[model samples]
Target: MTTPQTPGTWTRARAWLQTHPRAWDATLATAVLACMIVGSFADPGHHGGPKWGTRTPDAPSLTLMVLGAAALVLRRARPMTVLAATGALSLVELVTGDPRTPVAMCAVVALFTVAAHTDRTTTWRVALPTMTVLTAAGMLAGPLPWYAQENIAVFAWTGMAAAAGDAVRSRRDFVQAIRERAERAERTREEEARRRVAEERLRIARDLHDVVAHHIALVNVQAGVAAHVMDKRPDQAKEALAHVREASRSALNELRATVGLLRQTGDPEAPTEPAPGLHRLDELVDTFRHAGLTVEVARADHGTKLPAAVDLAAYRVIQEALTNVQKHAGSEAKAEVSVVRVGPGLEVTVLDDGPGHEGAPQDGGGHGLLGMRERVTALGGSCSAGPRPAGGFRVHAILPVQNHARQATAAEGTGNRV
Candidate 1:
């Protein structure tokens, strides 16, 4: 049994032909020349048919026919010029030669070349006159009679060549258009990827700023207190120094987590620690208290669980708020943090009692408030950071409690604990 042929073999053959265009053109030229030479000697004239008008061509006539067919070798390089040369030679053969030679073959090839490489208007412009003049010359001026089969054959061949070339040209244009569209789409995808990368870098920079600023501010304040009291109250100085170490350690850990996310590949062992959320609120408050800020915490959420993203956003907002109170609100500031569940979401509010400064702008000139609002907005939540009407600065964020991948992971952790 014979095996079926696959399209891959044909595809490879077509690719090879496309790569060797000059060889393909040379092959076409050779085939047309061979046909013209063979037809010249194969006397079709018969006792009664149209071949009755035939006679053998002479030596110079054969030479002229060869020259006409040879002109097609450069048809593709200069189609119109070659077509004109071949048309003139064919006219010469028609007017002077007996038993007409097939010099018209070269003109047909050149006309096809012109049509295939040019537009419809150009094809029409070139093809109509070419067909009319060549056919009229053969019919009116050749040795053959007016209604001879040879004259009609010239018209049919030229018209067919034009139509076939136009079809090929149309197919080529369509293929080129498809290739260009594909390239444009690929460029669009690359641009989109680059845009996403830039957005991610900005996000990471904001996270690093929030983390370093909050913890470092606490460390700076505690270090200053420790130095001022080291000679007088050794115990108080030691406690302040311990708080300094703890704040620095927290900053380093949070920094590692934020920076680890920037790694594009490979699980380089950084830290598998869970992100800080409501669970760490007490510790966060204790740090503020140690830094001489009296932080009061009130909760009405009643064990309401949150998605990891909302939890983290809530944590970051509160951290940045407290940090601002420490930095902008004077030493006498007392802050109140509230976490309450309302409707389908969790609301976190941080308020202070110190003398307030100018309100934080909505658009951004302050990184802390801007970063807080961005975090909340990304989660389909609303955030407000400004001076409270009564006393000091206020930060309020209401984040929805929707189920997501983070919630699922949190649930899994709870299950594993059980």
Candidate 2:
């Protein structure tokens, strides 16, 4: 915790400094000028330290030193200009005075600014030449030995300034990279969330399509039957009306359950019952049978347990296929549905023995076949719907059950642990 806290605090401080660069530069200028002024008054010749006798510079030389130091306040904005101006001022001081003030401090500050703002290639290019020229000029013109402390001090200060500035630049770049990575991760998370929402909405749409198409078709047929025989056969009409009522009621219940899922948090709770799957196939077939269509179901999977997703998808495929048969094929048609387990996959095939396409009803843009295909494909399965060679329409889907089941089990285990 301490380690993480330390870096966070340091990053905040660096950000503040970057935002107020002018103020920080002004502070640097003030410190550099103060050091030059105080050093000028100290006795350089005294081997005994702590002697501060003033060496009063001429008016013109004092003015130039003050201007050079003050110019450092603009170092961050115009580093090259400040460096050139301060370097020229320091050369002037070295040639005119016997014991010059340390105006080179301003040049050192400007060099640091340049190094921090620019790249290493530019820093090396500028630093090497500035160091050589400033040191040579001081040594050649001053009334001191070539190896004097003042001349060596100038080189040391300038070199340290360049190194320190480069380090600061590197740290700034590192922090910027970390910030970019965090933002990119945030963007990726948002995209994944949107993708999941889209998939869930598609699934819900498929469910609604299956429910509405199947139940409404049955109600329409039974209502037609009820109206057709109302005058002569009143008893048969009453039975047809009863079937209509039952179909409509089932439609309303399924619709209520589906729509409840889309309500807001403040709304009433939705039905908590699990969605329909293979166990409801018999009831589904019975509804079609009551509506005067023959639906045969043959299962050879031998009670093999299925994952929730696979089961739901299988149920939806059968429901949609049967609904298509009821709508397209005539009332005299028959549908056969078979679910078989072959190795690691489950195959569901629905076939209807109706008249060929010339006699079948035109679909007029239905979503049943497309929704079944989407559901099967999403589960990494294959589905095909077409007219059979000698008979009516056929829809076949092969779903890889074993892999999906194991994946769901693993996910459940991980969720339980969490």
lDDT of each: 0.84, 0.85
TM agreement with the true structure for every prediction: 0.69, 0.81
Q: List candidate 2 segments past 4 Å from native.
A: 1-53, 58-97, 119-142, 145-149, 264-266, 357-363, 416-418
lDDT of 2 by residue, 322-347 (tens): 88788787789899999999999999
Best by TM-score: 2
Please report the TM-score between candidate 1 and the true structure.
0.69
Tens digit of per-residue lDDT, candidate 1, span 1-418: 9999867987987788789876667777778778876787756556553342255668877787778767776777888998899888877887777867788888888888899999999998999998999888888888888798778888998899999999999999999999999999999999999999987887787789889989998998999899999999999999999999999999999999988887766779767889889999999999999999999999999898777778888898999989988877888989999999987889899999888664433333667887888878878899987777787888899998854545677989999999
Question: Could you report the Cα RMSD, in angstroms, for every candidate shown?
Answer: 8.1, 6.2
Q: For residue 76, what is the lDDT in candidate 2? A: 75
